[model samples]
Target chain A: MGAEREPERGAERVVVGDKRKLRLATASLAGCFGCHMSLLDIDERLFELVERVDFDRSPLTDIKHCGACDIGLIEGGICNAENVHVLREFRSHCKVLIAVGACAVNGGLPAQRNHLDLGQCLQEIYLTAPDIVGGKIPNDPELPLPLDKVHPIHEIVRIDYFIPGCPPSGDAIWKFLTDLLDGRTPRLGHPLLHFD
Target chain B: MTQPSILLDGLPVPFVDGQTIMDAAMAADIFIPHLCHHPEFKPQGSCKLCTVKANGRYVSACTLPARDGMEVENNSPDLNDKRRTLLQMLFVEGNHFCPSCEKSGNCMLQALAYELEMLSPHFDQFYPNRAVDASHPEVLLDFNRCILCELCVRASRDVDRKSVFSLSGRGIDKHLIVNAESGRLADTDFSWADKAAHVCPVGVILKKRSGFAVPIGKRRYDVEPIGMQVERLAARSADEES
Candidate 1:
């Protein structure tokens, strides 16, 4: 999809090449792939997205980091130190960064663990799980290091837009995406978001 | 025509079909655990403590609205275990110190915990580092005791339309927030009449100059366990909804 071309209602529209180039990439940080899946849940329209936007650096379309994209859609929370780096890069590289799910936006169910100490949980999970063992504990090297506290993206980096919910309803994501494609900042007009 | 008996823990107890489970328990003298429910004010079943496995599935006793065939087991080993775990989570999330708390002796949460035979929280502490805001001159903030049931926030938002209270953060970091610029509640437009003070189930939010005013022996929650009270209220409410 080109940055300058707009879609023509109901049907997905395509603006060829750099004529309307709207660079886009997606990254999944520290969350279940649920939010990413929701993006595709837009159904056949997502295939239309392929015709319109530059598909880069998404696990769905590409396997690289977004070097410099117009929009970076992030899914997950800023749990530890590595999350800070990812967020910073996205903020600097992408013209817009959207916190994509309950986890990324407000630190959802995983944040429930925030009630307890981090060391306590690591001990319980690694040492106390019936099947887990000292060496058997899986730790991803690429994973952002675990922090004592899990934080929402806004806590670490300024997010241009937030799409909250365990993964906001699919239609809501679509609405936001369309607005961004049309070249205007989209707002989540819900009162709850404004109460704070 | 019936101050009828409903089977509770195998014995026939007085059954008032329209009252809440908590209220029926109170009338029949049985106990059901609960919080965020009050007699003077309306019952807002946000706390989810009064949840019970009635007939097979989990249902909040206060909000479920009882039925005639409802076979309630207030002290069943299985149901009590769930209550224990839920109560433990509430304790860990914010802060609820029984000792040194104004609501300690008469608190609904404390009473339910005692009824469930809880000696102490088996889990680790969640000390969230929240501050106490005693700004209104009438109310106080005890960050440790909030369970985020959202009853107070709801009451303020829906009934009063005050927009003075809200819940910010989410999951475990979720805590009650005051509507102010600095995130300081005392700086807002809340007042004694807001009664946001009375809605808290734990000591997290307390009213100043109102503590212990009812005398130890006269306190309502201290006199009976919450489970029984929920049983009674559930029966009445079910009839209303149906």
Candidate 2:
């Protein structure tokens, strides 16, 4: 099937056969690297992917700050002040932002702590545990202060699309990216759309 | 005279005197999505997933009786979007970790979410601090996954005559509880074979030692979506009656 064009979202659509490739960036915060690992599982297709898009800021490039990009893929939820800052910065730099995974979409497993009092949780782990000798809660100014509850990325910034899975499969990621590259609104069918 | 019928999204559905809109639609092989509804149990209109416009008024199909010549809107885009919102509400209300959940594929909540195309929870996560009750040797109760459907409560009380479960608390504090002073399943006379044991639509009630027995790809909703499964079941039942 021919790829369908999507409505523009603050960025120019990538034209196929154009020498200039689309700029793509990715970020992970308060999430396990499972989503990134799945992205790598795109394996051989990564060669084809690089041909269509130039990596701007990602672990693959080790570029800490995101530059102006066409697409930004965010993984994980907002659990700390730093995560909020990073997410906002990414939103400002990228034209289209996609929340990629259960964590970024709905605050995955780490959000299990949302009901517990953050102070009590820290105390229970650091001071009252069985193995404790002279334990105390760490008081470092450099530490990113934890938010009271975990929040999905959309709660912090506008999201153009959402890819919902624990860590969406390698094939799912490939399909989504290729759809964007081809100017189609990414639509994940039964096999691709999964939470687990 | 003639069989009583209702117009379901412009399609006619025949029904008997006492059948609800849900029953009529099911018998006609038209799927009206629902949760907290079982053919064997008394209809509880708590979930609101089966809401439909009955003659221009919204009502829960499971509880609203079908009337002859009544027009009902079942599969409209507006209704489906509302259902998606309800599903999203349920998702964020509980701490649902689908990746690690034992009931992932076979779970009705997950299956219905997929059926309705719910991409994200759409709301802030509550992440309630509920405990798991593993006291029963043959069963497990993960309070984090309960949608407060009360299916187990009805199954235990009406089918098994055991009254082994009940819901306690009000509003947001509402939750399922075992029928024992100790608040443990092992302290009660509950059995794995009880009807309530297997009635849970979510991961709240899980059978011990049987998790992952069926691989991920082989589970109930893996090959077919829940809508098709419901329709297929309806067709089979209609065939049996004929």
Best by TM-score: 2
Q: What are the candidates' individual DockQ scores?
A: 0.03, 0.59
RMSD of each: 20.3, 6.5
Cα lDDT for residue B20, model 1? 69
Candidate number achieving the greatest DockQ relative to the actual structure:
2
Backbone clash count, each prediction separately: 41, 0
Q: Which regions of candidate 2 are displaced past 4 Å?
A: A1-20, A115-143, B231-242
Residue-level lDDT tens digits of model 2 in B92-180: 88878898888887777888888888888878777777889999998889998999999889989998999999999999999999999
Tens-digit per-residue lDDT, A1-196, candidate 1? 5644444432333335435767787887778878888888889888777666787678877656567888889888767787778778888889888888766755655665676788767777878878765633447787557888766677677777777545555666777898788777765432111100
Cα lDDT for residue A94, model 2? 99
Q: Which stretches of candidate 1 lie over 4 Å from their true place?
A: A1-196, B1-6, B11-20, B26-29, B39-46, B209-242
The numbered model that scores best in lDDT is 2
**Native contacts present in each candidate (fraction):** 0.06, 0.76
